[model samples]
Target: MNKSQLVFVPCPGMGHLIPTIEFAKLLINHDHRFSVTVLIINSPFDATYNAYVHSLVSSPSPSFPTRLHLTLLPSTLPTNISQHHKGTFLDAFFENHKPHFREAVSNLESGPDSPPLAGFVVDMFCSPVFDVADEFGVPAFAFFPSGAAYLGFLSQFYTLMERRGVDTTAFNFKDSGMEFAFPSFLNAIPAKVFPLLVLEKGWESFSRNHARLHKKARGIIVNTFEELESHAVLSFSSNGGIPVYPVGPILSIEGPSNPAQQGFDVIKWLDDQPPSSVLFLCFGSLGYFDQVESGFLDRTAEVGIVIGWAPQAQILAHGAIGGFVSHCGWNTILESIYFGVPVATWPLTSEQQINAFHLVRELKIGVEISLDYRTGFSNGSKTEVLGAERIEKGMRDVMAAKENEIRRKVKDLSEKSRRALAEDGSSYINLGRFIDDIMNMK
Candidate 1:
């Protein structure tokens, strides 16, 4: 039997690429009959990502049964696209790159000695390329690198726009305390914490197109486990025309080593702290702390350790790190959860605010810092500085002796997360089922 090969196309960002790669490793680890070829769309802003992808391909994981392959596809977005109309640039960028992506897939399919192309697994941002998968008669799956709740919300929002002709962007400007109910959440979601995409120009139409493509996918795979977002996963699976698989918390156990870790005195300092005593603050690559608010670090240095950058996975897994003050990027959240670290949520942009809300309110594994922090496309005002009081309060809440319930819940969830990747576990079984579905496609 010819080995089945799956093609993964991840969006240009490190967050997207890392999980897609980890998912590929998961697939190859669970079943020896498969191999993966990752097609990375190189980003001009992050040139180092290309080298990182190359390294992963060249140095296959020692644990996985098969090695994953990689191909770097040139980004088609113009350099000037970011200078103007930045809100819709991602939608525009992916649209422009579709033809090139299509050509690349075509060439791969026609090559001699190529494994049978089982299917295409594309990042959520690369939904437009489902057409490319169609051209070659292979199934395409949408890999959402976020939570199932966000997926459920998107599906629900799309339906509202179609049926009621509602303008979701208008919700952003509504009364400050207004909340809207979605099928996925038990409580109403505040407009402030809703996805930033709804407020972007041309977002309604872009989202409509995305929603249509989502339904057209062979299946939608989310990076969450059934235990974590049971209701949201069920809601998404029941309503979407396509099958939705909660097959994740798929994370790299050993992340790429941060070269900046060498001279950073923070790691040495962390070694001196008592176990579970320090709060670690990490905003992702695109996120940053305001200069004015940087003084909060000086004030709280004794209680916390702030680093500009560190090996996040390793840091989260550290014994001295008790709490995470995060931007609530899905990857960062998962890593924190996997390491049994509770969070103090400080959402910055994108779906992060929603993720933060879920972590603090829904799951009760994290404490809230400020849901009102203004950032992202919708906020054109001056950069909102996080007050020291709010920061200090969040730190206290996460580290409080009375908050052991939060700690206990996160620790239990961390074990579940580990088990979900084990043999016959939820994520393990779902991944196997996903692989079988692909193999049957051939």
Candidate 2:
């Protein structure tokens, strides 16, 4: 008869927020006795943040039963000592917000118990949650809000940094060469384009701080399916002294759309090209492309429809989309597989490089572009800047009918994804297990 409160604490970014919301919604729908709360990060993003939150709770759910709530913290900005804020004005933001956040959690710990605070599911970047959980003497779990392969890369970032040495660490973007070897598929990318988060210098302190915080958590919750990342998730569980739950394809929380899904008109936009003829492109909520990157979009337009932000679940459900030109983010990957769409990986940052690498080299479903390590190569020749032609060609190769072979290979994966979230699928089982595990934890 004990009611449990599952609080979802996400990172500051949209990519993290959306999927975590979906997970929270799923948890809420799973059982009537279980209630969910989305703990706001308390940053500038709070403005439009609540809208996304409202959309979920406002919708009707026929699956399980429960209600979703929101808990907003004042807001945590970057700090002067924070890696991303340093040299910028907001570096010390976290420093100021830490005490306020500490107070908030303490208050929650001491609050009334209609649905008592049973546990916390925190984002990987929310460092304050770890200490707050310890302060309250409550178990807190880390949510990566990304795929499993990316987790593997992050868990080993220290090793990658140590092996590369201080010289590479000190190198700036302008001077950086192909000195660092990235793990996963990103390892082959030039040292420059690996996303600012992976850069060792000037950012080392932030990375170290996050790694330490992650290790101290009770467990890690990943938004993925076991069929897709069983090995990597297992690796995390074994090493982290915490179990890593791969409960994802949570987008299915939208439930069955059935016949209307077939009539979902957008499929006509992709008809008659070829099987796997389309390359779906979406950057999630915050993935923006500047004029320099515009050519990549233009070139891909030649072979496929270029969408600014796709209703991914709807697009993936379509029969026309054969491949996805994705950021290799966890949610995208999970959704793609759920709909059986193979991927064309382009990792922007964080665990993307590793996710991209695993997709291309390990999963054999996609391909990635050169990461511009400043080796000065143009289509394998010496060049000043990255020309659009090569990117165009890469898109052509990825979207070609012959490459339909890759699509054929991914068909089973997609079906598995579909089956995973289905009634008896692995994702469904894991979700039930997750609630049971947390509720029963001592």
Candidate 3:
């Protein structure tokens, strides 16, 4: 069989880029007929983004020996563009790159020796590029780095508006007391806990545009296992005309982007502690941050390490990790599940509150710290400090669980997650199906 090329366009964020690369590796390693080239959007703001890419480009992992190629799209957006306003930045970046991206793909395909361009697999954030895919008469699949549940939750707002005939231009999310029984979530999620993007005023149009772009895509590729979010996965089949592929728990099991973040000191420290003793408080790349109070240093001398970037997977895998006080990012949630550490959820932004809701309420794999905290506000305003009691309670609930069942469930799921990557596993089978779908094209 002839080899095929798939272009992966992941936004410059570390969380999204890392998993996309891993998925690329999985595809090429599992089936020799596919080769991937990840096209990176220029993000000068994130200092670590390029550093991480450089690490992967320099040294590939052994376990999954992917000849995954990297190409950085030039900085086409003008320097005069305001980085402060996210909406302006997103629109500018998305629109500016269409012609540049088209030209780049044209160059890749110009050589007669190049493999047939099978499809464009893009990050959820880059949905606008489906237009580019259409230009080439190639299918584009939006790769949502988050889980199915979050995607389902996002679509619910739009679905509700469509069903109710609510005008997107006129509608305002002023009803704080509102609640909806989103299909993915087992219980009705409150308006207060909805992602700020869906609720905030100026963002309504952006959200609408994003959903519109998504409709143009051939399908969606979610980063979750069928065994984990079976309900949300099944829901997509009945609802949208588009297909949904849940092939994941896709992780970089090897190491981080920076070689300096290697786990020597942190591992040594973890080795010193007893089994199930440490409560980890690391967040994802942006540091949707949390910190211990100075007064409590004497009281709790230990959640103590202040390293720049610890080996998160290694730390989660350690015997000393009792539980995680997490920001509830999708990747973080999966890692916690894979490592069998129950989460004490402290959601900061994006779909994190929703994730925290699903984990604590729907899935029952974790407990909540502050589900609605700091999730509803952006633009560097609204920084409500959590009371010491809430922090203490969260730490207490995860480590010393009132519901021992949460711990037991997480432990069981960890084994299942590992198996999902194996040949006979659900994700493995879905991954094969994903490849077949690409080959069939559509």
Candidate 4:
């Protein structure tokens, strides 16, 4: 085995951090020689969150191998960026930190306890790490913690820019919508149905980072199975020859047994609900749904419980979870399918909307909200939200007897999801391959 190690740099937020942590754990368990260290970036972690993570890393239990380690870097958002600002604060945060990040990487490379810095596995959004990897003479791979279908959408960004031009003035291309259709895994979404980052005013900061990172990365890794998105995943690879690894259905990677051992009481409550009777709703940490949105969900309390953040894997593994009202992030999608729960999607930002489209259009295991992405506010600033009636209705349709067929189909998909991480399943095989590749790297 190669003496070099695997280093993961995950951006802040549970959506990004959880998957990377799981991946690191998987690598270490498979081969002790392959050490895994997770780098936490820019976190103002409170006692509760930090303690939870520390417990996982320090647990002397059999669940985690001793080789897994975590390093917390000094993290602080730029001076002007705080939690409350919604509008342009995101852009401002990125603008302020890009330069400081370069120096941080330089310092870490030379810092004590740094391994040979074999390679970097970074969140798709943390593109700046690609530059740092380049500076340190190591290959960096952007890990899209979403589906293969969504990664295919991003792989086409450069082509879309050239064919349609940068202005997005042609956004109203109803006439040529079919010409730019997304992958079959994405369902019925037109190429037009993406987030504001694709259509925002000018070389927006997010868009710039995405493009630069795509150009810099040695490869791209998506969290999905080939059987689910083979055509699109292949097309993405064929287009740029950008070696795509569809190593996913990650919820199944650790085993059919749930990895979330901490939340036992929550699992018991979930089991009390009837089959397909509950709806799991979560929007990661970065997502902040306002009181209006919260109230809408609260109104549906008679039908299902809506906790701020339920133990996702445990709940999905429960018998009562019939459907999901998810933000369509990658981890939720994979977990829901792993447990065979159908989805009702209302994706907000990042790769979510694209994921939502595929869940409804291609997979037939979910429902998508009829949101007007083309006309919505660019900054996600909005006073109004989907009403309780819509939420309740969508939930009912998914849980109804009339939709038994939907449940059956999703059940079948879940079987496939499980198989994907089974002994020879796609995800299982890919994970083994990844371990071997990284371990053998010279």
**Best candidate according to TM-score:** 3
Residue 429 in model 2: shift from native, Å? 3.7
Residues 185-299 of candidate 2 have per-residue lDDT tens digits of: 3334445545455554555565566666457876677777888776666666565456777777666434323332354455567665565556677765546555446787688
Query: Residue 193 deviation, candidate 4, in Å?
Result: 2.4
Off by over 4 Å in 3: 58-66, 78-80, 162-175, 257-264, 288-303, 375-378, 401-403
lDDT digits (tens) for residues 1-442 of candidate 1: 5677888989888899989988987788777777888887767566667667666666756764445777777668756764645545666777788778777777767879777788999988776788788888999999999988888788777665547555556744523565778888877888778776765655655665665656678888889998888888777667646777778898877777656657776667878989888778788877764563668867986666556667888788889887888989999999999999999998877788888888888888999897656475544353668888999999898888834899999999999998988888998888878877877877
Q: Where is the poorest 10-residue window by lDDT in model 4?
A: 252-261
Say which prediction, candidate 2 or candidate 3, comes out ahead on lDDT.
Answer: 3
Ranked by lDDT, the better of candidates 1 and 2 is: 1
Instruction: Kindly report which residue pairs in candidate 1 clash with one another.
Output: none
- Write down the RMSD of candidate 3 (Cα, Å): 2.9
For all predicted structures, in order, the TM-scores are 0.90, 0.77, 0.91, 0.79
lDDT of 3: 0.79
Estimate candidate 1's alpha-carbon lDDT, on a 0 to 1 scale.
0.78
Q: Write the per-residue lDDT of candidate 3 for residues 1-442, one digit (tens) a residue.
A: 8888899998878888889988898889899988888887756567678766666565655654545777777767646765435655666677778887898899889978788899999887776688899898899988989989888877667888678664434444423466778787678887667776766565665666666545777778889998899888888887756788888899876557455755547889989998898889976777743575677676666556656676789889999999999888999999999999999988887778888888988899998888877534344455578999999999998998433999999998999999998998999998888888888984
Measured by lDDT, the strongest candidate is 3
List, in order, the clash count of every candidate structure.
Answer: 0, 14, 0, 5
Query: C-alpha displacement of 356 in model 3, angstroms?
Result: 0.5
Candidates in descending lDDT order? 3, 1, 4, 2
